[model samples]
Target: MVCVFAIALLLLGPNPAKAESREQAVDRLTDYLFYRVNSQLNNRKLQTDDREYIRQWQRLREAIDPRVKSVQEVCLRVSPQEKGWEFTTINGETYEQTYDRLADTIFYSRHPQRTGQPIPTNDKIGISEWSAIRREMFLSNCGL
Candidate 1:
């Protein structure tokens, strides 16, 4: 469904006359993608053990990596697959974006209200790494 919607958007092109706001587009895109990923995670959790579940989650990146880059190009106008493209997010907040941040905005919202979100990635960071980043940030911010 998201792919179909994305494809429709690409085919239709920007309707400068009466288009939805950019912020609305960003929220719709990210929210739809996040919901899909999380829904898959929930289903995978039922069928696999912890290690396997994490593996499946990370494997998702391999498939989505391209679609995401396409979004950056077609929908986002951020240059095709440009790793450092930045953009505004849902709540009038913005981030100096990278491929990872654009893909993981849900996990790293500018005004994130949750804590200790499990970092999901492909051949990249994991719980241990997230823990280190979390603790290091805490200590660095409250330094001696």
Candidate 2:
């Protein structure tokens, strides 16, 4: 009985080095993108620059790295701004952000170019972009 259980475990357990499927890769990338956008939204709303918030944001940003290994990776560039930072992804996507300390607001934009102009919108932009990307990913490969 012990031998049979051990055999079952060997057959059923996950392998650490196995490659991810295309569907899984797409789903993971979609989820990571959403999480990254959501983290920015949270960071924009806080009244104070709490340490925990920064830590959480960093975690979410880091999570994106592992997913990139499953797909074709491109260039990622980051530039520090006066108030925030600009991030550009491999897929021709760029995020430019700025914070208005006096108004306590965050403004940002998403575009395909590295030096793309920001739309100067609020946090709701993140939600809208997330939904659009989710829908596109779902239709592309995740739905299959």
lDDT (Cα atoms) of all candidates against the true structure = 0.39, 0.37
Alpha-carbon TM-score of each model against the true structure: 0.25, 0.25
Clashing pairs in 2: none
**Candidate 1 ranges beyond 4 A from true positions:** 1-18, 40-97, 102-144
> Model 2 over residues 77-140: C-alpha lDDT tens digits?
3223212211223343332211111001111223323123433466476556544433422112
Question: Clashes in candidate 1: how many?
Answer: 0
Candidate 1 lDDT tens digits, 1-144: 999999999889876454445445444444444445455444332344555434433433332343322234334344553432123233333332233443343344421443346455552644444333233221011012
What alpha-carbon RMSD in Å does predicted model 2 have with respect to the real structure? 16.2
Please give the RMSD to the true structure for each candidate, in Å.
15.5, 16.2
